[model samples]
Target: MKESDILSEALVKIKNYIAANKDQDAPIVKFRTPADLDKIIHFTVDTAGVSENEFLDLLDKYLEYSVHTGNKQFLNQLYSGFNFPAFIGEIFSTLANTSMYTYEVAPVATSIEKEMIALMNSYTGYSDGDGIFVTGGSNANLIAMFSARNRILPDSRFEGYDRKVKLKAFVNEQAHYSFDTAANVLGIGSKNVVKVKSDVTGKMIPAELEKNILETIARNEKPFFVAATCATTLLGAYDPLDEIAAICKKYKLWLHADGSFGGSLILSDQYKALMKGIERTDSFAWNPHKLMNIPLICSALLVKKRGTLQHNITDINADYIFHDIDEIEDLGKKSIQCGRKVDAVKLWFAWKYFGLKNYQKRIDNLINMAIYAAKKISDHPQLEMLVPRQSFAVCFRYVPKFKTDLNQFNLDLREQLRKSGKSIVNYGYIRKSLAIRLVITNGELLEADMDLFFKNLLDAANNLESKCQLELEIH
Candidate 1:
């Protein structure tokens, strides 16, 4: 069979798998220990090519063991579902197999990336700002930190880490932990990445942020940056950007909004107020791969200051590779990576098909769905809300009114549901309380599914408790 024929057959199997998953015909994954997995699938190669028939057999086993993210029951992460337009763009870019380092070879890909970044900047209220697509949210955060460091201490780009500067980066207690890694990489100690306190809702309190800044200054630490999480991971709360921006202005600090989860809310006029005063921030990072339904690893770090990233990042001197062409058009020079993937095509194609209005409706629908789920839990006698609904992520717990250990009750409940293969909602500790973090992200997930999921969850909890009691009595 031709290669295309082989792939077509595989896609058919995948489609069937997705269709049957809703009816509980397949488990999310045929999970196994590594020792067992090695016995089932021929994973390692012995430096020899295999027959095409053998290849098909190996592919079947691999697919059977793999976890299906497109399945309706999948609610494990911040992202879910397969977008058709984005799928097409991904396939086309893979087939083209071009690097986006130079315009001489990748003119179309480079231009497409530039257009997408330009769009993000425009949405961010940057008149002549700049942005770039990065590998992930972590890298995007690093770019923001790097730019801020160089901008403030202009000589730090060339100077060694020993430069007479006490550099520090601040993040709300709820912010992503990437800044700690970034600080270590930039030669600043992890201790210098100060953790500011947040409110009960997981939002950065501006007064607390200013208090930390003043304390850091008193200790002679130069506070160059502060990252405000637009939407926290577990609670889904947003920091008050309008108040935080005022602090940054007062202290001459670089304010960065890490909107990896809630940034897409900007598309919806109604929800965009969550990011009020965003335009005033020095830098912003957003991941379409999360809420916007793009493929994984599609993140953009936008800046209000034009040419700032390029100036801070670009280290030029190679005449053979980077010739003196229209330098502004050369994107690779501005980025920290040399051969960036053609990551923009998927986002651009998805945007064209969905349009701004549809994206707005999609965002609204997510929030609405999460709200509905929260209500179902609240009304049910078996479950209780842990955190109020704010974004798509609803943090709730299963409670069976007899005053049992709620934490262990939730832990066992999560495992029982996962082992049964009926659903996939992971648990976490939010504010010292165990919570089932359900993000209403799958496009196919509906109200009926939510109702059934909750029912099954309660049934599993009761069944597990009965089993435990019977074992104890017998002993």
Candidate 2:
């Protein structure tokens, strides 16, 4: 078939699939054991030879197989459902197939990316800075840490830490795991990434941070980088960025904010206070894909120092690639990846589709939903709120009245919900205790959806309680 015909057919099929499954108010698939998966694979795949129609059918099935995370009840991971405008923009991005490196190849996309980065810098109050769109939050953090490493020890990249001094990157205990991962990838070792203690509310205690810095220095370790998490992954708490920035400035350390989850709040006037003193930081990792509801892989690493990343990572000096132009700073020179995807197009399109104020309104709605859910959970006698609602994620637990093997009960309840395929909610341990986590980052979700989720969650807990009682009686 012709490409146009194929594209039209695919779009139609996608529309049909979404329309049919959009109303599904529950999980799309139940947990399957190994034996069950073996049987399912044989019956579905082995029994029929593949054809175009069959392949499309499989596409529909597989697409809808997981918990419709984009569905109203999906509270599992950080990223939930798809945004309509961002989705459409992503389709266009794929069709364009442009690389972000060269303006000659992707002139429009390159300009859009630059403009978006400039807008983000303006939000952070960076006067003269530069940024680049990265694959995700993790990659952005890596690039930030890598740039900081190179800035502090200019010869480390080439000489492999010949300074013979232990370099340390500091982060709060409640910070996302990405900092540790970045440290490992940057060859700094996980031990060197000091975990400063966070208060009960999950904010990094500035005094503790300063003490740790002094201690590290006293131990003859080089303390040069500190990563402050704007919104923590587990509790959605924002660290005291202003105080942290003060300490960073006092020590002359490179301060980078991992605002992957909370960065979108920059658009909201009310929540922008959470990121106060962000402009003082050296670098920032922000993800529009998270709370902004843009498509995935749309994260940016903004640096206050204009050419710092270029100084660290730029190695390619081919005459053909680096021909003298009015703008000497090609984006490829600054980025870790050479042939990067044009990930900024969808975000630019999203911004265009929904104006900045409207986007902030969406963020405000999600934040309100989070607060509403926290209140609802707190009011429930059987449920206990683990963390205060800060941004969008609320951590809580279904604590039975009688504390008979509560951990086992909570774990079993979560497992039963997963097995039944009723709804998808996640449970995690905080401070060696189990708690359920609900992330309200999806802009498409409404208050009514949250009501349904809480209802189902309570029903699931009650069912698990009855089952446990029955087992106890039988025993």
Candidate 3:
């Protein structure tokens, strides 16, 4: 068979996978144990290459077992659903197979990356800011911390840290684990990464942040970085950015906002207030892949100050790859990675297709859907909401009329739903209660989809109780 035939077969398989997910009767996943899946797939590579037919067969098997994240019922993580224009852009990027290092090779992609960064900066009130597409939110956060470290200790980049002075970073207790990883990557021991206290709602308390900064100073440690979370993982809580900024300003600390999960809220006129003081932040990490539904790994680290990235990460003296080009400089000068992927095209395609206004409308609809789901869970007789709805994550759990361990019951219910392939929602612990975390990141989610999830969840619970030989009495 020709190469075109192979491409056609692959596209057909992808098309079928996408269409299958839209059907309400279709399972979000074909449940498979790790051992069972290993036995089913031919994992070993032989000495000879396989034929086109065999390759197509392998592709079919891969698609058949993979979880259908495009399904509207998929609320398993921070991201779900799919964008057609972005998917096409992903295909185009793969077809080109060019590195995003220099404008000489990837002129259009470089331009797109710059324009995308400028557009994203405008939303954060960064009129003269600069940014680069990164691997993910974690790397973005790491870069933010790295920038802070270099700004204060510029000599540290060349000659290691001054052992006499202890450096410290701060983040909300509810912030993503990336901050801890960031500290470790920067060689600033993780123990020195202070965690400020937060309110019961999971928002960082400004007063506690100030107290921590003062304590760090009293201990003779240099407090240089403070990170405020736009939306946390478990509760979807947005830290008060304006207040945090004020504290950071008072301490002269570099303030970075991690909006990886809920950063797209800036597009919504109604919800943008969640990140009100984003303009004052020194750096901001936003992931279009999460809430914007662009595609995976579409994350950007936007620095308010122009040339901040280049200043922080200067390229080594390598004349071979770095050419003094006309007017435009290579993107590699500002990036940590030499051979970056063209992540901007997918985002640009999705943004162009939807436009800013339509994107806002979609985000507003998602927030409304979250509210709707929260109300449904709260009103249900057999369900109990673990926490008040914050942003998109609605925490709730099923409560049977029988005396049993609520935590274990919810765990079993989640597993049953997963194994049955009816619905694929995630679960997390809120304090001590294990709550079902229904994340509303899918822009295509509708009321009917939400209802169907509830229906499947209740049916799964009833079936589970029946199988356990325990009568579930309606409370």
Candidate 4:
């Protein structure tokens, strides 16, 4: 078969896959156990290459089994929905298959990344800012801590980590687990990353933070970096950045804001107050892949000071790849990676298609939908609101009429919904109760969709309760 013919066939399959995903009746995921899937799909990698017809059949099977994350019902993860322009950019970048380390190899992509960093910096209030596209939110947090470590203890980079002197960092107890991984990776010790206290709403208490700092200092330990979570993973809580910044300033510590989940709120005039003191932060981590509806792996770490990344990350001996050129800007100097993906192109394309006005509208709409979901849960007698809605995550659970284990019921209900392909919402614990975590990250999601999800959830609960009752009677 001709190359053109094969390409055309693949495109046709892609179109069909996308169309099926958008269908309201279609399942978000055709759930299957690993053993069942392994038995069904051909996983063998033979020495011989397959024919074009066989290859096309394989593509069909792949699309048939894969989870449709772009579906409207997909609310299981932080990221959901799809953007066509960004999809095109993803395809083009993959086709080019070039590294973003040098200007010569990826001139247009390099320039586009720089533009994206600048654009993100403007919202961060980093007038003289610098940034680089990283792998994910976790990687962004890791790099943030790494940058802080290098800046605070410059000797550690060259002379190696001084085990004699203990260094401590702090974050809210509700903060992402990535910080622990970061501490471990940087040799800071996971235990040294103190978990500051948070209030009922989940925001870190400034007084508690200061108390922890004082305690660490009393132990004669060096308190270097403090991370203020912009929006926590489960609760979607935003820590008080202004208050945290004041404490960090007094202690002369590097304050970094982890805005990986809620950074898109910076585009909204009304909602941006959640990160009011973002400009005061030394560094900010933003993931456009999350609420912005961009493709995955589209995250950036923006530093307030210019040239900080290059100074901290770049090696003096890598002359083979990085020539001492004054005019050209090579991104490798700023990145922790040697050969990074062109993550910015997809984000840039999405931004261009939506523009600032439409993007702001999207953010506003999603938040509104979240609020709507919260109110719906509150009004329903059967539904119990586990925690107040903060940003886009609504934590709640269904309350049955008869006496039974609420936690187990909610757990089974969530799994049943997923298995039946009715919905794909997630769950997280709110103290003792397991609340269903309905994240409103998809821009295309509507109020009606929210209603439908609740309806399906209630229906699942009814059927489950009936089956359990019948089993009990039989026993």
**TM-scores for every candidate against the unseen true structure:** 0.95, 0.94, 0.98, 0.98
Q: What ranking of all candidate models by TM-score puts the best one first?
A: 4, 3, 1, 2
* Residue runs of model 4 more than 4 Å from their true location after superposition: none
Cα error, candidate 3, residue 348 (Å): 0.5
After superposition, candidate 1 runs with Cα above 4 Å error: 1-4, 14-25, 326-328, 472-475
**lDDT score of residue 193 within candidate 4:** 96
Clashing pairs in 4: none
Clashes of 3: 0
Question: On residues 254-292, what C-alpha lDDT tens digit does candidate 1 reach at each position?
Answer: 999999888888777877898999999999999999888
Model 1 lowest lDDT segment of ten: 17-26
lDDT tens readout by residue for model 3, 170-245:
8989889989998888888888899999898899999988998889899898999999998899999999999888
Kindly report the root-mean-square deviation of model 2 from the true structure over all alpha carbons: 2.5
**Segments of candidate 3 deviating more than 4 angstroms:** 468-475
How high a TM-score does candidate 4 get?
Answer: 0.98
Q: Write the per-residue lDDT of candidate 4 for residues 1-475, one digit (tens) a residue.
A: 9889999999999898779767878887788888888887777877897888988888888888888888888889899998888999999999999999999889999999999999999899999999999999899889888888988888777777887678899999999999999999989889989999999889999999999999989999999999999889899999999999999999999999999998889999978999999999999989999999888889999999998888776355777888857699999878878889999999999999989999999999889999999999989999988878989899999888777899998999999999988689999998998999999999988888888888888899999989878877898
Cα RMSD of all models vs. native, in order, equals 1.9, 2.5, 1.9, 1.1
